[model samples]
Target: MPRISRSEAEQNQADRAGPEFLEALARGLRVIQSFDRDRRQLSLSDVAKQVDLPRASVRRTLHTLVQLGFAETDGKLFRLTPRVLTLAGAYLLSNPIASILQPAIDRLSAEINASCSTAVLDGDDVVMIVHASPSRILPLSAQVGFRIPAFASSLGRVLLADLDDAGLDAFLARIQPHKLTEQTIVDKKQLWQAILKARADGYSLADQEVEVGFRSISVALKRLDGRTIAALNIGIHTERGTPEMMRQTFLPKLRSLASELQQQLI
Candidate 1:
């Protein structure tokens, strides 16, 4: 999945949604997105405030979710049910890339004793589709479905490099890049230059840009037609190596793995 700017993503959604679009269904999905790892459970008023919908509408939506086994309520707070995993499971099962990439990623993570992941570009972000971590660590780990800003992440830069000039302009227009860490590049011109460098180098490296003491290196997974389908990355603690080591050691491995994965895709 090539990276799409926020404006382009919105336009795509609008194009797919004809006049027969179901507003209620859209609202229901928004309600689902309101719940996250930090805010696992929310009251009706909380959800209404989060989604900016009326309390009545949120209540109805929550009730429908509970009835359909997507959510559960403990009389006061609403939380997503395990049944919701069905949706993620269905997506993983349906996407051959996700399913086929996991085992190889797991092997890579084990071999390097680091974190490895595959992600697809979404609107202004990259969403992890497959994630493997040494010892399956959780804290400070980016799990499947985790999203990171595309401008500051190595995986994101690789994916963003695939976009053409017009697509890149549209993305920059919609995204106001912010400094996540001291090393983060927020200026549009500077970020654009970084992207261009990644395009020329065939890989991207982010050293503590997303988070201090963390580093990542990534390569784009391209189809035979030269279309970027996803990005593959390896994450490590800053103590593990230097930028030169990452470029010389990990970069080659990531490129090889990305090439292997691309060959597996149609």
Candidate 2:
């Protein structure tokens, strides 16, 4: 028998536990996410080590990914190409919530004079779907396909807060929080507590984790059936709004907008 590494072991466990529709795709995404801005280029061994797959399995998967145009290699090193954007792009383009939420997001930005956006949870990150900034001057440069970890962004926490206890617990267990800045809550216990508070309060605030001197607040959008599908948020410089001001002024408007979208969704 061959040794099963941690990722392989996790995959096998998921294969047994999850519905048949999920396993392979989940494993493939794990491979794609293993590469990032810092480790843009990787060797076979590097990919295997990062994703915790066996070297042979990683090689085969990397080759498949390369052939699919999602990954590229120069024989010595492999990297993700722009084609990987299709994975996120396709989701954003096809998701109904994004379509319905875009005009609302645009209007919200115009009304508040801040950048507004809609994002959805993808694995452990929030993928930006629709973004509207008040002025081209205060640019919302995190484009539609940008992704950020759930533990560190207001958009992320708003989506996570909508999860049921079991789903939320699973998500929290998977997150490996790191200090993105002095304000980041890297401790799992504190992060979980914060999420609980977000759930109870019906919104979330992220203070300078995604970027220094910038902060955001978000509220989740749900269907009539009570399923959370996406989140709406506003990001601005700390000078514009403190977390308290966000909750007081913008939070109700966000909730109202999300409610209006939910009526359309159902």
Candidate 3:
């Protein structure tokens, strides 16, 4: 057995993407996404390995990003600059839901004294589009762009419950879930059942799934025409509330927030 170089692996991926694929643009975007919260600054080789591209290709992309002010290098490792935020800002500026929902979510967070957020599914992950927290420090370092695995998150399961049978099957097939915590559900059939339960109950409460002692509950945000477009969620530690308390106390508030947002969305 032979080990293929990173360049070969990337090229293979590009080849399967069809002739219309701009490998350079794909490579550049992959390079940008490779730098995340945990891997904020990476050397050229590190990024190359992460994105499965050649060091030379990654180097060129990094240099282009630096010249364009999207990234900066300390002569050893490359890190994304604040300008990269403009990319996300552009999306937020175009999407009025974030603005329409932020203030209300802020008020809701203050009222509940908890972290509240709304997220929409993107690919295999759920991306938070709006978030608010109490003035004090937060237990989870989540923001507007924070992402979590769909199978293990309360918000993600609520959003997933909106999918029809075929769509849900497709999503389940695409995901290769691993247990994040002892309580996380990694089996596809069980995950499907969980999403179905959320649909039946109109809400979800996930206990100690993503992190130890953390609990998150969510409700689906539907449009006037009954399309579930997003999920509204509140995250807390188990010390603050048990699963039953969360369902009894937090679920109604989350539902009210979602209802308010739905009225404004259309």
- The lowest-lDDT stretch of 10 consecutive residues in candidate 3 is 1-10
Predicted structure 3: clash tally: 0
Task: Give the better candidate number (2 or 3) by TM-score.
Answer: 3
In TM-score terms, candidate 1 sits at 0.90
lDDT of 1 by residue, 149-229 (tens): 999999999999999999988998889889888999999999999999999999999989998999889999988777899
Q: How many residue pairs collide in each prediction?
A: 1, 0, 0
RMSD (CA, Å), each prediction:
5.5, 3.7, 3.5
In order of appearance, the predictions have TM-scores of 0.90, 0.79, 0.91
Alpha carbon lDDT at 136, candidate 2:
60
- Better model by lDDT, 2 or 3? 3
Off by over 4 Å in 1: 1-16, 136-141
**lDDT, candidate 3, at 130:** 90
* Cα-based lDDT for every prediction: 0.88, 0.83, 0.88
Cα lDDT of model 2 by residue, 1-266, tens digit: 46544455786777778665455565688899888768999998998889777888788788899898988989999999999888777876887777788888888889998888888888898888898886663633245767888898888888888878999888878878888789888888888898899989889988898878888889888899888888888888888888899888988999899888888887
TM-score top scorer: 3
Model 2, stretches more than 4 Å misplaced? 1-11, 14-28, 134-142, 164-176
